[model samples]
Target: MFRISVLARRYSTKPITSYFKLFPQNFPHGGPPQDSFIINPKHLRREYRNLQSENHPDLNGSAILNSEVVSNEASLSEVINKAYTTLKNPYSRIVHFIKVNHPLHLDLSRDEISKDLIKKFQSKSTQSSLAYKEILMNVLEVHERLELATSEQELEELEVENEERIEETEAEIADMIKYEIKDWDELMMTAIRLKYWINIRNGIKEWEPGKPMNLTH
Candidate 1:
């Protein structure tokens, strides 16, 4: 087995930015490719265990003598943990993929469509103009419905519908990447819409009657 500890030791001085590269046996392409959107959970878990076994500080025994080695091992272990976690969850994995490949597309700071962004979209009827406007309208409608839901049944129905939409969008993302679709504006907007849907899902989970809707973004 190619040991992750070696990589950790070699690059210990710097941040381990590429988590996928740390586990070559698992992620041969460095990161999950567009075609393979989600990894098999069991396979990922096995690899995570193997990597941790080789690099975990507590298991390193006498290697604790060298403070530098211990520090590096500890850091490596943390990165490994984060890598496993990020890859395990679907939403996080999608976000990570976008951030790594199309970084400029994802803006975590701004959730809603800004006036400037809307202007940019409205300036001309591009490939994603109609789709983007539809999504924007859908977002507003979903939020409004959520806000006015008087019964759990209404919220549950909304949840089911939104979950279906999320699944469809996820497939769209996979297809976009697999086919090398270059409409980055549309792709970015789709990802941002997913973020909103996820937040809405969370708010639905935390719903309370007669309380202000705890929706963010």
Candidate 2:
């Protein structure tokens, strides 16, 4: 279901600027695509370090940037840094890979909208259908809470919830990839949800990292 092939690859190609490109061994065929997004941490870290050093202006190596062109080295270094940063985390890594390689959309099945928890969406629908309204409602709830959460306590709770959901989504992604399922609807749904919650958390932190969030009230 997930990307065993990608991680199992023996070798990879050299990447240009795309963060996913740095770890060609992870996805030799292409970025994620239909494969799993799981990458070995050791591989990623090693590649990141190598890329940084290779593109770094201070480093006097074969990857030497054009000294004649002012700021050329600096520009190259910045891009490399950005790429590494994005690919380091599973969340961002998956997002970046899919965004760059796959632009198509897949939705969750109807039976998936409802989860295991009672008073929830599970057992509420059938297979091969989408829970459109329920999905919209949940997304709305995320935005509402994001805009209203100001207190540190509130932020903490929100973080916990988001973290759990992210883990849940990732687990689902792994399972689906392992199973080698055909329809990607459920996988896409989880990925999209994780992306949304992650953005909400980042936006909040950036807008009110140290400031008193109680003012949001």
Candidate 3:
């Protein structure tokens, strides 16, 4: 059994800057680095807690001194916390991975809207853009489904069936991410679908029968 360690555990530590010149660069964008995609959450969490023990000024074990020192520790702690949060979740880690490792694959430049998923949002300038338009088309379609789910039976069925879609995308991503190198464009496409599926999941979880939802994922 993988004995999962609790994040809130206390330990002895030091000021991160006191020991090193650079902050933890393992997450943020372009981490695990450009060559790596798969992030072991357990490993990430272990590193995170270690850094948290040192950089986290809020923790008594993380050593606080004068006010100026406290401020610097506070800043380091903020960055570390963000990095840990981003790395812990599968979806966010994928987004950051693409941003860091393969900017060209994402190809934010060649379109009217720019790389805010340019391929998906582009206005039918090419065959692929036309297909990509389904991102929004699907969202609206699902929204209609959600609106029609005015009963618990319908909502239950909706989530139970829709969950498979999310799981499939996740499995695809897991397979691709296994390679340290990959076609980031394909991952991006899959990730975008995963995002919408997640939104639909969230919309369902938050919704109650007869109560309207904005459903804007």
Structural similarity to truth (TM-score) of each candidate: 0.64, 0.52, 0.56
What lDDT does model 3 reach?
0.56
Model 3 TM-score relative to the real fold: 0.56
Task: Tell me the spans in candidate 2 whose CA falls farther than 4 Å from its real position.
Answer: 1-21, 24-36, 39-47, 54-79, 89-92, 99-130, 179-181, 207-217
Q: Cα RMSD for candidate 2?
A: 10.8
**Can you list the residue pairs that collide in candidate 3?**
30-100, 108-115
**What's the residue-level lDDT of 31 in candidate 1?**
65
Q: lDDT per residue, candidate 3, 1-217, as tens digits?
A: 1011321132112322211111233434334433244456676677667767854534443332322334554675676576567656556656655544452323222232134444433543576676767777877877788887778888888898778877777778777866564555467667777777877888999987777877644
- Model 2, 78-101: lDDT tens digits are 765766677766556655544343
Rank by lDDT, highest first. 1, 3, 2
Looking at model 1, which ten-residue stretch has the lowest summed lDDT? 7-16
Worst lDDT run of 10 residues, candidate 3, spans 1-10
Residue 202 Cα positional deviation in candidate 3, in Å, after optimal superposition: 1.9
Q: Point out where model 1 deviates above 4 Å.
A: 1-16, 22-28, 39-74, 88-91, 103-119, 126-130
User: lDDT of model 1 at residue 22?
Assistant: 53
Clashes of each: 0, 12, 2
lDDT per residue as tens, model 1, 1-217: 1133542343223222455555555667666562367567898898789767855643454422332323544675676687788777666676666555643433323433233344555555665578667877887788888888899899899999988887777777777677565665566556666767877787788777766776655
Which of the numbered candidates is closest to the native, going by highest lDDT?
Answer: 1
